[model samples]
Target: MNNLINIFFLFLTLTTSGFSQKPTGVWDAFAFGAKGDGKTMDTKTIQTAIDQCHAAGGGKVYLHNGTFLSGTIYLKSNVTLYLEAGATLLGSANVADYPITPSKYPTYGGDLVTDKMFIYAEEAHNISIAGRGTIDGRGDDFNGPYLSPSFSGRPRILHFRNCENVQVRDVTLRNSGSWVQFYQSCRNMVIDGITVDSRENKDIEKSRHADAKGRNTDGMDLVDCQVVRVSNCFITSGDDGICLKSLSPNESCRDITITNCIVSTNASGIKIGTETSGAFEDITVQNCTVFDTRVDAISIMTVDGARIERINISNISVRNVKGTAIFLRLGARNRTYRKNAKAATGILKDILIENVQGTRIGGYGCSITGIPGFLVENITLKQIRLRFDGSNKPLLSDDDTRKPVPIAPPAVNHTVPEKIDAYPRGEMFGRLPAYGFYIRHGKNISLDNIALDYADDENRSAIVADDVDTLEIIGLKAKPSPNVSEVVQLKNVRNSPNLPKSN
Candidate 1:
């Protein structure tokens, strides 16, 4: 075939001449004097224009417009810091101009503080922090509750460690004293169209040893990263708006993809692990939109010993959730340091949640707890629709408030308490006898076309399954709670064969 079309046109002309060769040293931080007027201190003239564009061999360190009050800036290797929309890199409230650098792979118990941030990089590769500029992490001039010893004396506004081809595009990231971006152990990362807000100052006025308020301003903390792609983000956070951690017991946060995000959080809008010590396989959260979340619009937990399996959540839409739209947990904290000092129990298997929709959920509504020999296996929830604002009124005793408050007589079969080193949370087993989906110690579970709705008269039971085995509920539509008359509750359930009864 004519010598195979000239060897495929010389391999497409050597891959389009290596993508048309264009990185050739722009380097213009006001030509290395870097004033930008936000009160001097442009961090050694933007690190001498990024070490003279990495010694004249790489490119683009330009920053245009105004407000550049840096503190600790260091990015190297084929750099591209190009900000120029009104350019403002401003972070520096003078906590000694941020100079620490502890963490030689030390996490909790080695007590991680890890300072030296405000745009830092280590072992870098093709790095980037693209335009539409604004990286202002002047987060309340740093003082928080984050385990306060002055909270590692505050830094972190973009710390990339052991990086690879990373790209942080269209940045707006604002007001973060800690964890506004800490992509540690990175790989091919691309955080596109970013706009994190970090809810600045958080009503600051507390001085008698200030305790809380934006105490871990997490907007993006993807630790032990791999092929990550967070798209079109608009995260607003006090903590946990988009967090995924696997703090290196051997490094694992495999192929992740968080698409079309628009999260709002006081904590946990899309979270994985409370810092699980390694292993979270292929994760995908698509077309997201959570609003006013106080916690759990989607939180998957493998308390510290890791091994969370393939997860997929699709087309989510939650609004005004003060807590629990979906909180999957498998405990046994075991905060890492194996070699047989007991730390091995952690495995939450393949999970898939599809077409979710929530409105007004609060307190212990969605849970999939596990621990009694560790169940939580293959799970799937398809086409779920939850709506709960049922006012939670079940305290009537002065002659029953117009009668019909009787659905509490089923208590003799105990075996729900295997907290397994507590702190997994969906209120940590407090008040749960189901308000809307409270499955426990699960096994191969599946719920197709589930719909739970409530707005006023609530007493309990929307769907509660304790000690489940092979549950498969299809087309469940919860309604019966004229004060609670069995809207599905089965304790000590075993080989559930298409179970779906009480309505």
Candidate 2:
């Protein structure tokens, strides 16, 4: 040990010359007395190396050739932790190993998340984590219940709060107790070439019953951030795969682009807000693939008085979407996120989704709905093809097969509800009256070159538009059910183009 210490100082001296003016060099964890034996606690030594690197005006803290069990790595400014291929940074299972990281940013329910975090950086700039190593949060061993923003005993794998110029690339991140990574109120971030897998099983219902350890392992969350890029990634999780949330009325999630990625999850694959207190603008998502998702493959919502606008999603492929292909909702769920926070109905508008294809979707159809006065506006879907699993029309009595179709005018009006404050879901209105698309309370919606089909025998209209304005459909090709009298039903719709022509 004495010789090792002498060699370390000698190497430092040789690298730095007479003065300790090393601008950039690799700071090895082993030099700081870290035993990467997987059983020992190397957190302090690794943190010390990071501190030294930061103090020396920035360098890389190298961790290689071992498995390091650690907790709560606090990354600082201009510092980067480069993990080599043979190294692994494992999260400690003990709950007390993580500290409580406080924040002033209002989010989800405005309650503090039960965390510090496994890898935490707060108010730091020009920070990064790049490598080929694996970071395992070991979420399977964590015991807790997910009850919102205040649930205890679960910690996020990575949390970068109020930061700038953050880059996370080429790492395998998985098994978080809650959301795998949370980037809140950050700017100018790039997350590229990363792989994340946190699913407990292929089937969520069976997995929840089989393993009752942890909950809510979403893949990645970008909250109220701007100017971000995410590309060349693959993610699959127990919850939403990639999420954009806006939880503060003062800040909006804007200027984001996500491309060339693949995601699968038990929840929605790509989503924007269950937390819509702010705006989502200038976002583009293209060249992505989503599969094996239990909810809508793509879902966008504005429920808490925020504007969702100027968003584009193109060239997306989906398979085995258990709920629907797409869901857009503008609701008046004017619930407060925090104390003294007011709520109001928001606007959802100016969205374009084109060149999307999907198969093996459920009976919920593609729903785009708004409340009475707040209409979803200026949405367009072009060159989209989707197939839904057929459904039998619900009957008043199953014993009599000759019952009249329950999806008539009076029944259709009552089939959809105005659940203003409820969380948005494609199936929230239950089985829709349409088999292909259910559009209500919408304005200036144009569906062009849409091809829809069903796997089994369906008994509903191909499209149903209620309270829709300026509705237009071109080259509308669909397989209408034999029992349905009309292929498309329009109620209280005004300013629409000619009735759709079947291709």
Per residue, candidate 1 scores C-alpha lDDT tens digits across 108-210 of 3444445647888877899899999898888778774464322366777898877899999988988778778888778999999989997643321222113
Error of 1 at 396 (Å): 29
Best by TM-score: 2
Backbone clash numbers for all candidates listed: 0, 0
- TM-scores for every predicted model: 0.37, 0.90
In model 1, pairs of residues that clash are: none
- The TM-score obtained by model 1 is 0.37
In order, candidate lDDTs are 0.76, 0.82
How does candidate 1 score on lDDT?
Answer: 0.76
Question: lDDT by residue for model 2 over 1-503, one digit each (tens)?
Answer: 99999999999887654223344577888877789899999999899888888877887888999999998889999888888987999889988898766665544667554364788887899999999998888787776765442346777788888999999999999888788999999999999999997886566324232444336788999999999999999999878899998778888899999999999986789999888887899999999999988777999998889899999999999998766789999987776666787875698999999999999887666889998888999999999999887774221211111222232222333267787777786766766888888999999999999999988878788898998888998999999888888888888888765964322
User: Which regions in candidate 2 have their CA more than 4 angstroms from the true location?
Assistant: 1-24, 104-114, 149-151, 204-214, 392-414, 500-503
